[model samples]
Target: MRIFAIGDIHGGLRALIQLLNKMEVKDEDTLIFMGDYVDGWSESAQVVQFLMELSQKINCIFIKGNHDVWCEEWLRTGEVNPTWYMHGGKETMESYEHFSNEDKKKHLEFFETMKLYYLDDENRLFLHAGFTSMHGVEKEVFSNTFYYDRTLWEMALSMDNGIKTDSVIYPNRLKHYNEIYIGHTPTINYKSYLPMNAVNVWNIDTGAAFFGKLSGMNIETKEVFQSDDLPSLYPNESGRNR
Candidate 1:
């Protein structure tokens, strides 16, 4: 049984479908999604609907993202967030037009039920963004840290490669997990189109919101799977490029 951690979807349902097809997931396999299921392309509602159905068929863990927070709020209260609207939220809002109020309610429940973070049996940590507490996720102070923090990844990137795990200067946060997986900060921003590792922290987000493709990584084998770049699949759409 394989265990895979999927990156941010960002409404690229076509890319997502292609990547999943390439992965050829099995019934016994477990999927851990790193969130940001909406916001970017034109199929936000469709992506949510697919994930909801997918979860019902297999073992799946969904992590909530900041973009998801905005989308969920809009679905629940019909109040649009200005920042979200500016950043692909308009497309997300518009995508729901064909759906009934009942469908919207079901989608809202899916989002509401998502976890902020997930810790696997192996002690690996999966979260949308980062956590600041040196003591680990359980000690996180900010309610939004799970989906909004970047310092954890930043610290990992800047950490000296020569520092041994047992060294006194090693980050206390890194010691709490066997491995840490995250997806908020796209690896494409760093010019890497594949999963990137800075120490034990692995970033699976390959920038599907823009020019990159949907990505998924097998946590056990470190194997990566990705779709064609989002632009290629949806040539007519800008997909949050502006």
Candidate 2:
């Protein structure tokens, strides 16, 4: 069975569907979504609904993201966060206007049930953002760190090529897994619109919430599949670029 890790969807349902179609995934394949499934494009609720149905037919591991935390809280309390509203929550809120109370409950459950991080039998680690504990993710003190940390990717990016896993100077976090997959920080910020690799860490978030495409990568082969730029699909919408 093949294993694929998908980057943040950010409400880009069209892009998400396009990326999935490009992958030609089978039921036997395992798809690990790196999170931020809502907020950004015009279809935040639709994206979640699609994923809810999609999971029933295939192996899907959903990782909760920081944005998802904001959305989840809003769904549960009806209290909108100012920061979340500024960032893509406005779009996400609008997308749910047509959803019934029952639908909202189910989606809320979907968000609540998502994993903070996932570890496979092969020692591969997947999380929405990053973690801080040098001892490894299991030792992380803050659950929010799983979806909000950037230091993990930054540490990986600044890692020296010459430092071996056996070296005392090596980051302890890197030594815990065969490979680490993450989203949150967009690769576009670094000027690349593709999944990036630094040492053993892979940043799959290709900035689908901004101007870049939604991406999916075969973890075993490192084969990439991407959708058209989100703006291209939703021409009238600014898609968080605003």
Candidate 3:
């Protein structure tokens, strides 16, 4: 069975549709979304609807990202951090015009049901962010470890400390998993894959939400597919809207 892993979508519905069309995925294949599915782009609702529909047609695994957690909170409490608006939450809210109360409820239910991490029998683990080494092996799935790990996000965003290098060392300590597929950290952080590690960790986030391309990787072959150009969202430096 072919397994295709995709990076942070951030509500770019067109890109998502185009990527899926390019893949021509079959029923036997498995599709894993690395997270950040909603927020940033113009079609957040459309992206969610498409993913909801796509779930029926293939083996789909959805891993929740930091943005997704914020979305869940906004849906539940009717309030979200103001800073999130600057980082694509505005687009997500704008895309909800067509959704009814019941539709939203169902969407929230679906979002809540998503797993924070996925581990397969082949010793491949998929996580939206890196795993917290403090959790040991089996306790990694608990909601606290999965949802509230601030250190994971801090390390992911830190550039000075060489957190990426630290992440490369982490999987060697795990006795079970042979490879970890992560997405929170964009791939631009590293020059190339480290050669010494037994654990093969592949990060597919190509910074589509920023000024980068959307990326996907075929799990079996490790062949990457990427969009040539970024979608128009933010304005250019000259103050002209894209």
Residue-level lDDT tens digits of model 1 in 149-214: 999999999998789999999999999999999999999999999989999999999999999989
Off by over 4 Å in 2: none
What candidate 3 gets wrong by more than 4 Å, as runs, is: 134-137, 141-172, 189-199, 232-242
**What local distance difference test score does each model get?**
0.95, 0.95, 0.69
Model 1, stretches more than 4 Å misplaced?
none
lDDT per residue for candidate 3 within 96-186, as digits (tens), equals: 8888978788778878988888888787887876667654446665664553443444443333433344475543334356676777665
Best by lDDT: 2
Give the per-residue lDDT digits (tens) of candidate 2, residues 39-82. Answer: 99999999999999999999999999999999999999999999
Q: Candidate 3: which pairs clash?
A: none
Deviation in Å, model 3, residue 144 alpha carbon? 5.7
With a 3 Å backbone cut-off (N, CA, C), the pairs that clash in candidate 2 are none
To one decimal, what is the Cα RMSD in angstroms of model 2 from the true structure?
0.7
The CA lDDT at 103 in model 3 is 78
- Model 2: weakest 10-residue lDDT segment is 156-165
